[model samples]
Target: MTLNRSIGILALICLPAAGIWFWQNPTVRQAPQLSFKTIKGERIDLADLKGKLVLVTFWATDCPGCIEEIPHLVELHRQYSNAGLTIIAVAMYYDPPNRVMAMAKAKQLPYAVALDPSGSLAQGFGNVQLTPTTFLIDRTGRIVLQNTGAFELQDIRQRLNQL
Candidate 1:
């Protein structure tokens, strides 16, 4: 095939792939009721967390960005739990329970870390491509803000204050 034809075919292949990826990954419109087992092995239902400011962050154990943001999340939970905030870290990819426990212990995370071994919860929340996606749900259970990447402490604080 000619160089121009080869380039055209490559573009054709890449364009559809990009489109599919973009279509499959969009900001979550409605929050789904996710039921998962916490690292402590207790079943928790997302609907049970209503009437509180909840941060549902989807992350994976191997994600560097997710690892880096744990401390910030811990701080947010610490500063605001007394104010009726609930932060739940939903692990999108499966890892050994020990690893999850160790990371939580090392960071001294005060919030609950749940396991989404099948990643269905992550997909339901429109966080297909990224780890560390955070959704802020108000007391009434409406998603007020959805962040696809790592967030700053100030941003989290401001969002919490608004709730």
Candidate 2:
């Protein structure tokens, strides 16, 4: 193979490998402070959820993968909330606010939902440029996992089991 072609193949292979490593063994990161009003006009903040495991997801209404993840998120919240788990779904700025709100309502999502007008919230989470990115934060308010794309639900549950 040509040198450039070889390098391209290697990059394609290694980049995702690195992302998986980052996702599974995320270094402890102090979660970016978050405070926002939900679509239901309820205010929420990470600080307020101290001592609770939290999952913050960045998504858009038009993203099928994001839509696919909602039921899993709802299940997680319902099963774990009393045990101190919290979830916040932040809708990406490009999606119309009305549609975002509609999706949350139609799904009857059990977690907090916030709309980003200009993607600032996603930027704080490492400039999330895609739909369905998720971060799992520990009870101590540090991010323990970061997954982009269609995150495996079983993997997430396994990680939570560890914590």
TM-score of each: 0.76, 0.83
Candidate 1 residue lDDT tens string, 1-163? 6999999999999999989866744443556787878888788777888888888888877889898898898888889999989888987766666788888778777898987767687877764658778888888777777777887779879878977
What is the per-residue lDDT of model 2 for residues 32-96, given as tens digits with 9 covering 90 to 100? 88787789998888888778899999999989999899989988888888888888999988989
Question: In candidate 1, which residue ranges exceed 4 Å CA deviation?
Answer: 1-29
Please give the distance, in angstroms, between residue 1's alpha carbon in candidate 2 and its true position after superposition: 46
Worst 10 residues of 1 by lDDT: 22-31
lDDT of 1 at 84: 87
For each candidate in the order shown, give its overall lDDT on alpha carbons: 0.80, 0.88
Highest-scoring model, lDDT? 2
Best by TM-score: 2
Cα distance off (Å), candidate 2, residue 156: 1.2
In candidate 2, how many Å is residue 7 off? 37
